[model samples]
Target: MPIVSTSTSAFYERARASMKDLRSQAETLQAQLGSGEKLTRASDDPVAAARLRTLSRLESLSSIDTTNADRANADLSLADSAISNMATTIIRAQELATQAASSTLTDQQRAGIGAELDQIHDDLISLANSRDSNGHALFGGESAGNAYSVDASGNAVYIGTNSTGDLPIGDGQTVARSITGPQIFSFTDASGNTTDVMATVKALSDALKGGSTDPAGAAADALESLKQGIDTLTTGQTVVGTRLAWLDVVSERRSTLTELRTTEEASLGGTDIASTVAQLQQTLTVLEASQASFTKLSGLSLFDNLR
Candidate 1:
């Protein structure tokens, strides 16, 4: 018969290694509980960590999109309000024109109407040069200053760009932030001629103030042109309204996407507190039992048995 022998040193080494492993596991679970995250570092879960990084970058970009959408919404709403006021002003000008066209009125009365028309002309010029939220031209199409400027002859001339420029809202989309001065005021007249709201009003004011042989005839002619100008303004209002609707749609979509991303972030990296705590308790219980067993085994000796 052959006897197999096991060294006491080997037994101690094996027992110490097992207890060390259990202690290391208990410390790791405790760390996870303290941190409130599943991953201690990128090395702990490389795939989950990388995915979290990507989600974080996407969140930052979404925040920027939200800001841009808000700015566009504000500028467009301002443009809509200004357009409505201008339409009201034009309607008042039409009323004045109607009164001036009356033959029953004396020359003096017509002159008084002409004076009021002059004030209206000035008001239209001021409206055209209205400022935006940034103190720049609202209808100037990205101009740093006013949209219209008074010339040497007191004519309001357009000094703005033709394009209002586009703003990026998100999800591969863009919106025109504003309408240009020419877009709101300029149109084709019945005489197959190019004319604008400011020019039409200025011409009528000049005619009524003794610049024409027949003031009544001039006022009648201006009525048709003014109607055309109103049409142009109405068209601009429709465009602004459509863009605002589009912004609302995009904003809703962005909100939904943001929520989805947030949910994914929580699922990928956030720790499950209830499950983690239970796991920690089980590990601690096993570690304590191993420690007690190791203490008793390490203290036992063959020498004591021989005595």
Candidate 2:
């Protein structure tokens, strides 16, 4: 019968396994301390890991919304500045119209006034076709080119799209980034006919230049058209102001929500340093004791073999 040497070999294998298990536990604890994270892998806590993933996804979405909001606000600010300048120019034109309506002005004086009116018309068209910070047409909606261009008839025509290009500022929220050219420059007269500021100004200028039979009537018509232009601009400005207020509210709410997500993510994934430290110490103590016992047991086995 072969002499059984199973006891010593079996004890050695068991001792090695025990040491490996102890070391593994200690290493895991140390890693947690080093990383300041409780769950190094998804397997550590499946529910927590899943929640973390959801939070991460939401964070990414919020970031995108923030970017959109920022760009939209910038565009809106640019629009407001441009429109304010336009209002000022239109006011000046209105004053000129009032003065030209007087019969005391000579033909040469009217001609000079018409020349100035032409300049104002050109400036107004330039304002209508202005670009935003990103160089896209501010009043052109989604069009990349100039917002207003003259057609064959010499009247300024809207060459851009009607859409103001609404952008997603946050979940379930969209806003118009800018006002379209037509919204600011076009109007309907009391007679229910559509008219544009450019046409009104240009026609007035021509009447003065060509010495219309009724210079006073021509100037009066131009003044009425300018009055309508100012009203249209005022309404557009109000709409833009309202939109800007909405953006402010939405931006604040998003910031609060992002902060909440950050807190929740930390709660689910962050490590407990004090508890982990205690656990690591306990594991080390146990491992050291086991090592000592294994050393004594191995010495006894060797001694018995010699015997």
Best by lDDT: 2
Model 1: CA > 4 A from native? 1-36, 296-307
Q: Estimate each model's TM-score.
A: 0.87, 0.85
Per residue, candidate 1 scores C-alpha lDDT tens digits across 1-307 of 9998878889888888887887787788787778767777899889999999998999998999888888889888899999999999899999988988878877788888888878888998898888877788889998888899999998999999889878888878899888998888999999899989989888988888888889998899999999999999999999999999999999999999989998887788777888888987888898789888878888988888995
Cα RMSD for candidates in order: 2.8, 3.7
Task: Point to the candidate with the largest TM-score.
Answer: 1
Quote the positional error of residue 172 for candidate 2 in Å. Answer: 2.4
Tens-place lDDT digits, model 2, residues 80-107 = 9999999999998899899899989988
Candidate 1 to truth, TM:
0.87
Clashing pairs in 1: none
Model 1, C-alpha of 201: deviation from truth (Å): 1.7
Q: What's the distance in Å from true for residue 298, model 1?
A: 4.2
Give the Cα RMSD of candidate 1. 2.8
Error of 1 at 278 (Å): 2.2
